[model samples]
Target chain A: EPEVTQTPSHQVTQMGQEVILRCVPISNHLYFYWYRQILGQKVEFLVSFYNNEISEKSEIFDDQFSVERPDGSNFTLKIRSTKLEDSAMYFCASSGQGVTYEQYFGPGTRLTVT
Target chain B: AQRVTQPEKLLSVFKGAPVELKCNYSYSGSPELFWYVQYSRQRLQLLLRHISRESIKGFTADLNKGETSFHLKKPFAQEEDSAMYYCALSGRGSARQLTFGSGTQLTVLP
Candidate 1:
């Protein structure tokens, strides 16, 4: 079965630095999303991207966060300035164009900001 | 606002015993509910969806709109059933975005 793939399974960055977490969603999927989970916390939605634009975003996805589909398969989330609280497991998910289609999740990238 | 609640942080059951993972949601509009499981070292994957109304790997979940719950259940649990299960919800307006619960870690002891 085809699955979503993410790069840099784990990353360590300094505070105030920028980091990009990349994901290659299933080839045929049309909608992409980004979610994060702080250690011991529930998964939180960050943003959703479709048609090269952001569909919705949460308060956590503030000015420092941005998502881009620079290529057909690549969906990238960039944090302009990383903070200690920004450390978490970031997951990328994608789904087909139907309302009932379940979103497939990637292995997730663990971001650690010191 | 849409929210998912999985009250149990951990549940342990012996093999061959029945297992039930509770999930409740709060959403004004109709919402889509799903159960995702993640085994150790594996990525989170969809286990079942309420709309399908089908069983997967001997597990089934019924969407109780009156109770606003979609609890997952299996009649007989196996050792392989040990994993972290999350209850998620997607509202009509934000179908692509999912709000997940804190998750329940089920351990099926042999």
Candidate 2:
């Protein structure tokens, strides 16, 4: 079975620096999403992408956050000027066009902004 | 606006015993509920959804609109059932982004 894959399972970066987390969603899926889980907190949705544009986003997705499908297979979440509160485990997920609600998640990338 | 609540932060059950993970939601409109499970060091996977009304891996959940609950139940718990379970809700229309509850970590002892 195909699975969503993410790069740099663990990322440690200095505060105020820009970081881009990468994900390769399962091929043929149409919808892609980014969610984050802070320590001991529930997973929160950040943004959703479809048709090469953002379909929806949460309040947590502020001006500092941006998502792009730079290529056919890669979905990237870039955080400009990271803050300490931004430290969390970021997960990438995708679902096929047929079942938009059934999302398959990638092993999360743990980001620590020092 | 939309929120999911899993009251119990942690639960424990012996192998062969029954287990229940409680979940409640607050939504004005008809809600779409789902249960996602994360095994140790693994990604979150869909266990089941209320719309499907199907049982997966010996687990089942029924959505009760009156009570606004979608509690996950298992008749016989196995040791492998130990994992973190999250209850999520999706709103109507195209976005369908999930709003998850604080997960319940279940430990099934052998």
Which model scores highest in DockQ?
2
The docking category that best describes candidate 1 is medium
How many residue pairs in model 1 have overlapping backbones?
0
**Which tens-of-lDDT digit does each residue in A12-95 have in candidate 2?**
999999999999999988999999999989999999999999999999999999999998999999999999999999999998
Question: lDDT winner among the candidates?
Answer: 2
* Model 1 whole-model lDDT (C-alpha atoms): 0.94
Which digits, one per residue and each the tens of the lDDT, describe model 1 over residues A31-99? 899999999999999999988899999999999999999978899999999999999999999999865
Give me the displacement of residue B41 in model 1, in angstroms. 0.7
Question: Could you report the Cα RMSD, in angstroms, for every candidate shown?
Answer: 1.0, 0.8
* Candidate 2 error regions (>4 Å): none
